[model samples]
Structure formats: C-alpha cells, structure tokens
Target: MSTRLGWTAALMLSALSLVPARAQDAPKTWDVPMGGNSYLTATSADAAKRGGRNDRWNSPDNVTSVYFRVDRAAELNIALRAKVPQGESRIRATLAGKAVEKDLKGAETADVPLGKVVMKAPGYVKVDLQGLKKTGEVFADIEALEVTPTGKDAAAVVLNYVKDNKDNNFYWGRRGPSIHLGYELPKGEPTEWFYNEVTVPVGSDPVGSYFMSNGFGEGYFGMQVNGENERRVLFSVWSPFKTDRPGEIPEDQKITLLKKGEGVHGGEFGGEGSGGQSYWLYPWKAGNTYRFLNRVHPDGKGSTVYTAWFFVPEKNNWQLIASFKRPKTDKHLTGAHSFLENFADRQGYLSRGALYGNQWSCDVKGEWHESTVARFTTDPIGRSLFRMDYAGGAKGQQFFMRNGGFFAENVKPDQKFTRESTPAKKPVIDFKKLEGADLGS
Candidate 1:
C-alpha cells in the first residue's frame, strides 16, 4: 500500500510541473492619446484608469480609433476598460484589421477582452471602438486600452513596442531618430556641472533654433542659435519668490551681469511667476565648432549660483557669459538635454540639422563621468499640431537631430567618443584682464 501511494504522489507532482508558470512581472501600460489628430475622438473627461484621464464617444455615429506602431511581430492581448450605461449594447472592436464583437448589459464598468491578433511586423495596430446599440442617452466611457503581451516572445514584443513608439510630440507620423546618446542621472541624484562640444558644418542651414540646456526650471544654463543667424549663450536662476517682468524680479532673484560679449543684451524674459533673465544677441558664425560648459554651485549663505561659459576655436580660450544667484536653495543640476528644432512659421516642411557629441558631467563631489546612451523624444506641439517631419540618427561618430529644410542623408549620430581617463583641464582665462576689456563690441 505504501509503495502504491508513493507512485501516485510522484505522478501528481510531474503533472503539476508540466503546467506553465504565470509571468510574475507587472505588464507595461501605454496611455492612448484621445484628443490628437491621429486619435479620432468626440470628447474627453477626467475618468482615466491608467494615466490620469480618459475620453468618451456618444452614440453609434460617433466612433473613435487609435493607431499605434510596434517594432516586432507578436500576439497582443488587447482589452478595453470601459463603463457601459443603459441597456444591452453591442461594442465592436478591431485589431490590426481583425474584428470582434461583445455585448454589454446593465450599468457597471468592466474590462472587455477584444480577442488576440498577431502583429506580423513593425507597423501600426489600429483599434476602432463603436457602439451598435444604445438604449439610454450615454453610450460608453473609455478608461484606456489595456494591451498585454502573451506567448514565448512576450518580453521582446513589449520592449520593441516601447522602443518603436515613444511620446515624441515633434515628429508626427514618422519614425524616431535612428540614434541618440542620453545620460540621465539616477532619480534624485543631481550633478553640478555639464560640458559638451557641438560642431555645425560650415554653411549649415538651421531651420529655426537649437538648444543645449543643463539643469531645469529652478536654475539652468546653455546656448541657442536661432535660424542660423541669431546666436547667444544664456544663463538664468529662478527667484525664491514668483513674479514675471524684470522690474518685479527681486535682487536675490537676479544674476548681476558681470561681463557680456559685444551686442549682448541682459534683461528679464518669460511670463507669469516662472520668469528668468536673458542675456543674448551675441555674434556666432556658422561652420564653427564650439564648446559649452555650465556650473551650478551654492553660495555660502542661502542661494545658488549658475554660470555659463563658451569657447570658440578662434578665441582659443573660455569666456564667461553670465552668472545668477538663486536665493535659499541647495540643489544640484537636473534635466540635461540637447535638441535641434525649427521654430519657423512654415513648420517641418523645411529641414535643419546639427551635430552634438563629447558630453560629460561632474557631480557635486567633483567626480567626472562620460555619458553614452541617450533616449530620443520630440516636441509635442510641433508633431501633433504642425505635422512636421523630424529625423534623428547616428552617422560615423556623431549624433544629429534635423527638421524643417533639407538635410543630407549621410548626416547621422554614429560618432565614436573616447572616454578620458583624467579630469578635464580647465581653460586659461584671465578674469582680471577680461573684467575691464571692451567685450560688448
């Protein structure tokens, strides 16, 4: 009897082992944009299941659909988390051209599974939702579409989907930039300085404006070249208090203009309580390679100082742009990024491009490190509203972002960067000699 029981227990254990284990990781959720041009929508509300808000469409005539792109072929478990109001109603859903129908009765909210479909390649997943029958005035409230991956390649499928589809608002109806290098500091770990080199090929036509900014809203420094004509290096610090114009900006909120290049103007800019000072209109030439350096350090008392410096190969040295002090704060730098954009009225019908590389950062402890991998994103206003064509890619050893106007096909972000073993050498600049010298030419 004991031998027979052991045999039966062994058989049961083997059968249990044959059953597959459920995926332990939480599924990634993507928020569907309902108001944009690509997403055909009737109305939006504060009811959201995933993000913060959702949309609603009334009646059968008002139908809505969303088109999403993916990079791999895999099976997707798509479902709609929605609330059905009124009597029994028919809800039709389509995934990648395949259609399914479901009937909802009563007035409760539920997740309606919309059948699985195989995405054969890197392409769009078109989901359409409409009500076939509505007994009451209200039809449905769509919280969001819950898309879960199923099968052996589920992990790869989710990764490919995220990589192919980013919330890039600047490049509408187009693939993302081929390559980008971003060094995002670990959350809550801020740095004190950033340094990088940018090269604009001779006679490079910039569409509108390009910016390289380090730090964020509280304090920031960087440079901007507008329309390949206007060039300026900018630095600003937020005031402890909030207000707009220069006159109302407190003295502690202001960065004294110590020195500036010829034709540079220093004053306040921006709107509302979130304003900062601007020192711009400096002369910058095309086809010239330049170095940008920024520093954010705290003052002894209760303020922080933000400074910017620029180096032109012609000058062979670093020159200070400006420095501002922010009152009562001990914070390091945050949100470092570089972008190429066309602020022209014609939008992305034209093209402009530039090359940026050799990005490095220094922590508050004075340790230096080089940044390698970067995630690519775009301007939301330009992509959805203007419908422009923005392209980013790597070529050789350089990475570039281009939009508006014409760009050469070979321009890409393939530049190779060599890590420096030693700390960066400071440039030789005599502040004493520059203090009185006529810089504002």
Candidate 2:
C-alpha cells in the first residue's frame, strides 16, 4: 500500500479508541443531606447544636462527621455545601485516612471542594469535617456533603442515605434502626404471665435506649435511660380506642388504672399512641441482670387487666410497677416479643445493646415453659434501606441485639435462633402472695 493509504488506516484505528472513552457514562454526583445523616463527634458532642437541631453542623470545637453507604468500592470526589456569614474560614475534610483543607468566604452557601477519597470496599463511609480556623462567629453552616464519583469503577457506585425530607424521614433516619426478637411461645397453652431477664453491658447502655424485656399484644414493660441522671422502669398499656391523642380516646375504651405501687407514677400518655403509662424512677445499674414479670388475664367482665412487676437485683426484691384494666378487651397475651429502640434522635449516633435471656411463660394452670426459639426482626426504618445498623441473634444461651452507631454489620429480618434452654433455672414464685394485693375499690 502507498504512504497515503497507510496514514488513513492509522487514523481510523486511533478514532475507534477515542469513541469508547467519549461514550463512557458520566458518574452521578450525590448530595447527602446533613440533617439526618450527620453526628456531632466532639469532646462535648452537643456543642454543635448552637445553630439548630441535627441539621446544621456549625461548631468549631470538634469534628462533624457525615456517613453514607456504597454498594462497591469507589474513588469519591467529596465537597462540602457550606457558607461563612462573614470573613474567611479554614476547614479540613478527612476520609479514608486522607485529609484535605480548604478556605471559604462566600455570602451565600456553595459547594466547596475538599478533595478526593478512596473507599477500599463496599460499606459505610465516614467523612470528618473539622474547622482549622475561622474569622466568623462559627466555622461554617455545613448543610450537606456533595460526593461526585469518578474513574472507571465510579459508574458502579451507589450511595445510600436519608435522601430527602419527605414523611419526616430526617427525624426517623437520625434515630437509626430499631430491632426486635419475636418469642415462640408454646402453641397449646395460654400465656397468663411472661417472665424474662435483661442485662445491659457496661458502656453499651446509652441515653434514650429502651431495653424492652417483655411485650404483649396490648402493652410493653421495659427500662430506659431517660436522661443523664434518670433511669426508669416503664410499663404502658394502650387504649383499645385506637387514637394518637389520648384526649380523643372514648372513656369507655380508655385504659383504666387499677392499682399502683408506692413511688410509682401512673398517668395517660400520647404521641406514639394513647395509653396508660406507669413508671418508677430507679437507680438501675448496668452489667447486672434485671428480671421482669408481666401478668395478663381477662377479668370475665369483658376487660383485660395487665400487671407488671420488676425485680431489682440490687435490692433483691420485686417491686410492683403498676396495673391497668383495658376496656373492650378479653384476651390473653398473644404477641410475645422484645425490642431495642432509640427514642432520642440526637442520641442515634451512639451504639447501645442489650441481652435477653432465660425467658419463661406461665399458663392458667400455673405451669412454666421455657422459650428457646426466637426470630430476629427490625422496624420500618431498617427495611426502608436508609438506616441498616441493627443486629440480633442468639449468642450461646441468650439473644443479644445491637443498633445505631452506623455499624456495617446488619442481621437480616426473619432470622431464627435457638438458645440453649436452662430448664433448671425455672423461676419459683408464691402465687398467693402476689394475688393477695388489696386492689382497692
């Protein structure tokens, strides 16, 4: 072939190579909101709240972290959506063992590039933003983290997080995921009483955590970390009227207070549901096993009565929490389960866990049966694919559950577990003594 023909053939080969590069799909840029996707990881974490609720991270005291998930390993180009009210501010973004510093000074918020990060594997990734220096009142009102993936593997990346504000998801997403264990009661017998024990490990008990030990069809009996200085054993029974507002519940279908022990506070509660709530402020310590006993039975007057008593191991005595009679209900305990939940949205960044073991249920004939099998499950938050930090299963002879803290390990729902039964440890109770309480008129 001539020199002209050879040059034309070389050009055709080079053009073919360029076509593939130009046709490659552009990687998408994900704008992850900070309202429901960030945590204040500082010396005094709540110090970041000067601006607003969990939505704004404006503190210069410590690192403000944002978390999200990816399906595959990615080389992420990350930026911060922030603005300085006045003057310039210096900030640092750290991710995957790399840190990038940038200075910003803008009247309005804008996407400020912090540089690139490479996630080695698929899972949750944490990006820590710290204020190096600032000339304004605060470092910057960091609204969201803008992630733009590039490179050959970038097109395979999919980020998962609380994407929007619809349906109050920012509130629920920040609260993390709630997990539960469904107990398998004996099929042939009636559950007149449910007995279970809960032990929260030291350092695993955080504020706003509820370790529900016993749950029935109408109510639940559990203990919670209400505040830094307060802990309570709580029992509540729902009104059959089915309303979110307690004032709207018809008097006939309302839950009536039957009796309460000394120092126990009993009243009506609403928001989650209308119910009669009872609680006793007790100095419950962690790493100690606490026992819960719940009694449910029909009063023959077409109403069901629920009574709860919690054993204080420190005092070695079972104190009555309260008792309530539910109108228009004449059934025994049916749905037997225990759940772990975080009620405070701000506390969702911390990890908490509890152990449920030695479960037993008594029938009308006064025979106790052991519960060795259970199924692990999660709430809608877990299934929504937004928050997946939850786990539960049998570890030796007890079932343990862990949630929050943005952990990567997640236990799938409907997973069954069987713990070794401790039949020799059956509870011995004096039925006559418990029944002799003077439930006054």
Candidate 3:
C-alpha cells in the first residue's frame, strides 16, 4: 500500500474484505454524522446550531438536510441515529420525494431504520429530515444518518462523506472546498499592478459565494454575496506581525490605513489571520462584467502600500475601494491567484461559479504582461480528499471555477490550464484618472 494513502483509504481497504479501493471510499456502511454534515437550511443561523453535537433539531419547522455521495447505484437502507426523551416524536425523511416516516420513542440512542431506496445513478444525494410531531421536551437528539447497501450489487458500492472529525474537518468539511487559479507570471518581473475581470453568470451567483478576482502573496480582493439583500466588494491585507488576534499586533507591525474611498469601511479583521480589512456594499449584478485592479509598491522605507480599485460597467468609471500600508514589508506583488469559496457554511449546499478573464500585470518598468495561463489548485479541504466538489479550467478565453455544491467529477487539482489569450481585449485603464478620483485628505 502507498504510504501516502489516507487513513480513510486504509479503513476502506480493511473493511472491503481485503479488496483495495480509492481514498475516502467507504466499502461498508457510511455513517455520516448529522452534527457534521447536516444543516438546518430553513431556520435562522441561531436556530441552525440546534443541529449541532450537543443539541439537535426539536422544532418541527427546522428543515434539516444531510448530504453524501455514492460512486455507483445502490439499494441503500437508510437509518437515523437518534433518541427522544419522554414522549414519542415523529420524523419524515425524504429523498427525491420518496418519503419515509419513523417514530422515535426511545430514550436511548438507536439506529431507527427508515426503509430503503434504489439509487439508479452515481452522484451526490441529499436527505431531508423534518420533524412532524413530538410530545417530548424536544423532537429528538439526532446524531447521524447511516446508509447501508443491501442489494446483491452492494459489494461494488463506494460512499464518500466526512469520514471522521480529524483535523477539525467537521467544520471545514461542511463548507466544502475552496478552489483557486494561480496565474502564471513571467519570471524576474516585479508586478506593480494586477488587473483582472470577473463575471458571474446569472444563475451562478449564490449567497455566501466569494468571487475573488485578484489575489497576491499577502492578501485577496473579491466580491461576495453576503445575503439576498446585500453584496460587497471586499479587500484585506495580512499584517506582517503574524498573529490571529488583531489586537496583539505591535505598533510598528500594525497595518496603517493610508487612504480609503467614500462609502468604504476600513477596520481590523481577525480569526484566520489578523489583518486590515475594507469593504463597500456595492450591489454588483450578475452577467455584468466587473473589473478589479490592485497596485503593490514598496514605499522605499521598509513598507508596502496596497491600493485596490473596482470598476462598474454601469457607471463606466472606477471607484477606489481602499488603501493600506503594511509595515515591515518591502516587495512587489507576487504569487498572483484567484479563488472561488463559500464563506457561509449554512449555504454550502448551493452551487456557485465565477468567470475570470483579461489577466494583465504591469511590471515596474511599466510593461503590460498578458497572463494567459494558470495552475489549478485548491485549499487543504480538497487536497485532503475530504471534499471533491471543486472544479476549475479554461472556458473560452476566461478561466472558471465552481465549488461548494458537492457536484461530482471535479477537476484534478494542480493541473495547469492555459486560456486562449485575447490580446485585443486588454484593458485600457486611466491610471492617472484613478489616482485623481477621491484621494483621501
């Protein structure tokens, strides 16, 4: 066996009657924990946590859903691991409108079988569980959704899910994979400016989706669907201080706010990595191409200033988003990339995509370098094989990436893709005009 094989692979091999299979393949029954892979999509964010480890769905209104994948057709016998204290409760489980109702009256956890169904194809499956009626303190303390193949052809079935809670993957796995496109840049060329355009197809724009256009070594610039009523153009830069807590940054290492455009809010953001964050609530629409431009230049005094601008086609003008100077750093933009990610885990079940095109980087010598090639990659979630729902490649002259929907047949990671360059479609930007627009006092 290859030492590079994951623990899930080893487990699958051991359970497959000594027959080998691919990574994250479940030859036996797949026990997908409800706390890890389930979400209450119809409830508020506060009510959704009721489906967590300690507590579970009690309200009949909370529409809880769990998801997984099967590599082949299977006669799947579905069951739920749960317990109801006091009186009895009812749960209606539905898959493709084939509904099964189960009564939960036991105070102790047990595998309550919800009958069987024949999946005629290979793909992701979503099981919806809803509370019908209950006479107890809560509907039930549900834990996991177990699926066992019982048909004669079950021996060839392969299942995929969040196999275990290792590496705190339960939280990370729920949100799915974050996919990227690394733009290939010329060697030895210092990039002072990076310009890229992104267009979200009409139906591809989903809530919680971040369509990142320009990503450098230090930070990323993107637009995100915050909610049904809110969207934003966001930009952030990590502090060289290297701390997860923004307050811990030293005075000299703190990100200095140089300037910001009107309607843009600038503040310190923490959690992933402490950094200065800025955003503007701009209602950018789908199907309309938006332009992103970023400039990275050293201040000659051991600091680098980053300025971002957004161009809206409706206005036919560019708006300076924000600018910040990071201390203890002196370098031009390096490692240019773009990514598509789902920021809200509750909305992870929804599909989203973004089209990135017209990548051009201006060197310090003021030469415009056309970037027609990019390397496809993903975050650790995809690399770990924990989630394989991300895809990226060249579509026409633009590069596109889709993630978070659990669609099958993902693009292989770490593959290089080259888009046909449209040299005539290169951006004709007025740098001087951008410099003159709303300079902060």
Candidate 4:
C-alpha cells in the first residue's frame, strides 16, 4: 500500500478506537457539562428534584430554543423532564423540523416524551419550544433533555459520522466561528505562565484574523496574525474592562508597552477588553513556524503583570512584545485557546488552517506541565447561521485546526520544538537592510 494510504488507515483505526463500546447502550445526556453551547438566552439552571441542576425557567417571550449535536442517524427517544405551570400550557416542540405538541397541566414535574425523533444526519438537533397559548409568567421549567439512542452500533455510527462530516466550509455553515482547541485549567490550579509554538498556514481568505490566546474573556495575553491587505503580527493584552479606547482604559486595567522592535506599532485598539496592542508590519510567510510565550505573575505592587514574547526562527532570539498590568485581580491563568476565523463579510468564503503544539503551562508553584488535550467547540455564529466547514485533530504530536472550504482535510500536527532550539538561526528580515527601506501603502 502507498505510504499515504497506510497513514489514512491508521488514523481511521485510531479514531474508531477512541469510542467506548458502552456508548451503544449509554444514552446521551445534556446538562451543564455541555458548556455554553448547550443553552441560549433566558435559559437558566434550576434545582432538580433528583439531584444536579436542571436547565429550566424558559419563558415564551424569550428562551425559545435549545441546540445539541447528534453523531448519526438514529431513532432517538426525545424526552423532556419539565414542570408545566398552573393552568393548561401548550408546548410545541420541534426537532430537526419534526414538530410535536403536548398539552400540560399543573405544577408537578414529570418526564414528558416528545416522541421519537429520527436524526437523519450528523449535525445539530435544534429543539424549538413554542407556547401556543400565552398565559402565566413561564410555560414550564425544563429539567433535562434525555436522548437515548435506540439504533444499532451507536458507538461505531457516531465515530463514522464524525469522520464523514469533519471537513467544513470556510465562509458558510460549518466554519465561520473561530474553532477553539485548548485546555481549561482546573479550579484552584491557576496557571502562572503559558506558551505555544504555531506555524501560520496560508489562508484562502485574506480578510480574516487568527488568534492564539492564553486566557479568556476580560483578561488575556497572546498573538494574532491579521490577514488584511497588509499582513501584520499583532501582540496584545486585554484588561478586565469594556473601554472604548486604550487611553480611556483605567490605569489599573491598562497594559503598558515597555519596548518594541523596529517598525512595530504600539497603542490601543477599540473593541472587547480594550487594552494595549502592538503590531509589526512583517509579511510573515506561510508554513513558517513561530513561537509565542506569555508569563503572568504578580508585579511588586499589588497588581498582576502579563508579559508577551515572540521568537522569530530567523532571528533565533526572543523579542519582547508587551507587558500589561491587571489590577485588583491576582488570579492565575484560566482559559487557554486558539482559533482561526474570518472577520470579513458573510459572503467571504476564505479559509485558513494552523498547527499548534508544544503548549506548556506553569502553575503558581513554578512547576510546568505540557498540555496534550483540549475540548473542541464552535461559536454561536458558526453553529447557527454559517454551517461553515471546520475540523481539528492531532497531526502526529502537534494538534491542528482547519476550517473553511468543503474539501479541506485535517492536517497532521507533526511540527516539533524545544527550549534548546532557540538562538540557532537569524530571522528572514535583515534589520540593517530594511533600515532605510520604506514599506508603504
């Protein structure tokens, strides 16, 4: 057999082996563990009678629907554990375009089967709840959703289904949201530092932005390769505030630029978590590997400091990106993630792929650990509107994320790196030669 065919077969076998044999009999349960993707607006958690919290308190005006993914076509027993409010309440539940209605009464909670839903394919199962009669504050309190598979070879079916739908388009449907792959630190084990090596891949779309972030939401530190008309390497830090401009950001939540390289711009950009952003107009070529490092530790003064660094292979040295101070919080690093997405128009069908690996994180005690696992997830826009194509998997030791275009296949994360590999080579740019060069628009 050809070498490529041999590798393909091996990968298929490995993927299938990851599925537990008991999954055939085990029913898929949706709860809090499913993360933010499971619930929508107005859907809050309520105490369940049996134990654990039930996703409930959905009203007619708001909480209209819920979404979940199914691996294959199967006979799924769709049932809802809920309590109907006082007076007769009509709930019209639809799954995969199939609709069913139940006329419920009283305040007692019970498991109401919404009948069998035939999942025709491997995709999201959107359950829309509509109250036919407008009465009372809420229609019902949804306790849980039980999806028990009644088909044969459930485990095998799910694995095969994923393999078939793994590739997603860049612009529409499956790949629009930044596909994230990273580890969320366990509670109490906050990360003091984190770093990763990534090779920026060429993208079909030149308008999107690729982000490698070490921390989530209000506070984060990382690098971005903006693929606008002029390609640039952007290193930034976000404070825990929602300010319009960087200067307007409070001192306590500001990220100060201590130093920068030639041609690098330092300032604040508007948007979420406004803080400090440093950009260098370097036309980073595709397929070249780059290393990003971030250290989060407490500054002498009561605040925390986030420092970013980039290692250019050609320069064989690490360059300082920026340092930002986050006041009032001395917490450790929380979320570590990377994503490839487009920020251009919806019709923009551009696609991109990137390899990320050698991810290391240090705890407050100064111990370091290599992260090897991550939970894959999509954004709301990608999950709902754009069925964009996207997929992530290990390419050897490295893990890669690819999205956009229907034919895009998974790339092997075989790129390797080490601490001793630095200071070995100079960067592609000749600082002396570019000294008098004007890279203009």
**Top candidate by TM-score:** 2
Instruction: Give per-residue CA lDDT, model 2, range 1-441, as digits (tens).
Output: 111100112211222222223344567777777766876666334643352233233445666678898767778888776667777888888886688889989867667887887877777888987878877766776667778888987776888887765677777888888899999999877888899999999998888899999999898999999988899999999999878899999879989998887899999999888989999999888898999998888888889889999887766777889989998999888888999999987678789999999999999888999999999999877888788788899988899999998877778888999999998889998755663133421
List where candidate 1 sits over 4 angstroms from the true fold.
1-182, 186-190, 202-204, 213-230, 238-263, 271-274, 280-282, 346-348, 382-388, 405-441
Model 3: per-residue lDDT, tens digit, 1-441?
A: 111101122222222232235355443677776544666557546554543221345666667777888878878888876667679998898975689888889876667888777778777778888889988767776667778887677777887777665666666777778999999887766888899999999988887899999999999999999888899999999999888899999998998888888899999999889989999999999998899999998888889889999986777888888888888898999989999998776667778998999999998887898999999999987887767788999988999999877787778899999999989987787677885233221
TM-score of each: 0.48, 0.89, 0.88, 0.50
Winning model by lDDT:
2
Descending-TM-score candidate ranking: 2, 3, 4, 1
Candidate 4: residue 311 Cα off by (Å) = 0.4
Where model 3 places Cα greater than 4 Å from the true spot, the runs are 1-27, 43-56, 151-156, 436-441
Q: Rank the candidates by lDDT, best first.
A: 2, 3, 4, 1
Error of 4 at 346 (Å): 6.0
- lDDT string, candidate 1, 1-441, tens digits: 011100112211222132245456844444333222123333233222222112334446444554444547777788765556665668778776777888766655456788887877644566877667776655565545557777776766642111112343323322222222354554434677677666666545543454453545465555565533566666665666666655776666654544454545656665534444555665666566677777666666766666666775666666666665566676667666666544333222234556766667777566666665455555443333223234565454455656543222322233333333223443334433542233221
Q: Measured by TM-score, how close is model 2 to the native structure? A: 0.89
